[model samples]
Target: MKKIVILFILFYSAVFAQSKFPVDSSYTVKSVYDKVKKAHPYISYVPARNYKTVKEEKEIVYKKIKDRELHLDAYFNQTKKRNPAIVIVHGGGWRSGNKSQMETFAIEMASKEYSCFNIEFRLSLEAPYPAGIFDVKNAIQYIKKNARKFNVDTTKIAVLGCSSGAQMASLIGTTNGKIAFEEPNSDKKFSSKVNAIVNIDGTLAFKHPESIEGTVAGLWLGGSYAEVPQIWEQAAPLNQTDKNTPPILFINSSVPRFHAGRDDMIAILNKYGIYNEVHTIENSPHSFWFLNPWFDETIVYTTQFLDKIFK
Candidate 1:
């Protein structure tokens, strides 16, 4: 009787653990940061390192229309054989940020044998609504067109973005081959489809009741949900899901505001039988990708997700 009771207890414990959320549910931004800092004092204080081993090619023009020149930075391990690739977009509330913001993460990914492209897209200051979307789509098309030059496996490409960039990455992943978002001058011959996506605490829906006026999404989208309902609906990634949507992995911060509408997006994904995962970093800020401890954790889940889909 004693042996049976112990066995049952152990079995129940294992099952409960397995069924729990994939992320650390207990950690919050402040607590996790404090804990990590206590152990590694320099974890959040260290400057971004430009991995010396990874070869980097900067400012390669990916799109040229009229006088406007959009460029992207590429990083990779020198090899003749084709390898999986990822295009990373930076986030700054849709109005700021550049390719440099993604340099550290891209370099680390390149060191891991993935061809990484840190891309530049038009910001709200330069263009609004679908302009950034078109720029990102063009970047993917450019990468696909130059796959041989970069030794990138055309079929095994993924996109990763943080903040507003995550919104863009999610959009690109969900609306692949959708004609409505395609740019006029983009090389449409090469499909802009990606195999997977990684969204780091980005907004997924602009029409969420929580999305108010003066917010990043509202401003970048050129109006509030009530003012331009059509545009809001059109810009939302959650509404764009279909059976063909690629697998997505969301690495989020502890802030509930950052994950608004994520549950609804996941529901749509499930309804379509699409693969998706959400892993939250407890007690971490929305910008956790730039800090340590959380940064390493981000890479682990990212690499795991990409590997699973690419395989």
Candidate 2:
């Protein structure tokens, strides 16, 4: 009797969990847009106002090499044929951030005939440095492995992110086709790579003299410049750029420290004969470009660049 009771309890829990995120066609694009607006209240425009779910796994499960149970949310647009894809990485100083922050962007991309995904990676304090990069690589591989099912053009996929996510995005853009930090092959034979990148106010170098005292470098990298110099070098996206890497779009603000040395990165790309673009906002706060009219301009410029390259 106790065994039967236990089984029934497990069954009910599963059902409850499933019921919480029930899929409903009645959940219109406008409604989803409304939810996004309610949450952000800052984004100025909504592009992908509608999407037909090509694929969705609300609580898709993944077990890391470390045996960590990672939950990922994924959605794909079925409405488009052979669409380009964009994977979004969110930012929270590498210690905190979720996949949800990219939902509106994902939905908008889907609406615009581009398959999109918002990814969640392990956090810094929660996990560590290479873990986040590992998770992102895994996500890219997962998408490529399921490309046909999602109607995503694996060859044309782009990565975009903000803050730490921007660091990851730049990492992908600069390191595509390079296996600098690849894990022991747990799944497939190929490396995960992106064709383009959109990075927003992301830190590129941990070697900055300012990073010596106290800044994100100390917190996320787990030590001061003197303490973990090699770790900083290894974590820097600036260390990863090459010729075969994707074309890049850099979005920076007028804020001090944050936008510093981005031009240096562009210089490195130019030295390597790589294609890149920089769009700097005139006298704005760090990531404040995410607010009101600024967001609209940012999105417009970004999407316009995407359009130019995608075609």
TM-score of 1: 0.83
Q: Candidate 2's residue-wise lDDT over 1-311, tens digit each?
A: 99999999999998777542222232233443455465456555433344456455555654355445555566677664777888888876676657765676666566666777787777755656777787887887887777787788887888888877888788777776566666556366545778889988887776664233256546667787688888878777777776776788888776546644577778888988877888887755555434555666677767877877786
Global lDDT scores for all candidate models: 0.82, 0.70
The best candidate by TM-score is: 1
* Total clashes for model 1: 5
Residue 188, model 1: lDDT of 64
Q: How many backbone clashes does candidate 2 have?
A: 1
Per-prediction TM-score, please? 0.83, 0.78
Cα misplacement distance, residue 270 of candidate 2 (Å)? 1.7
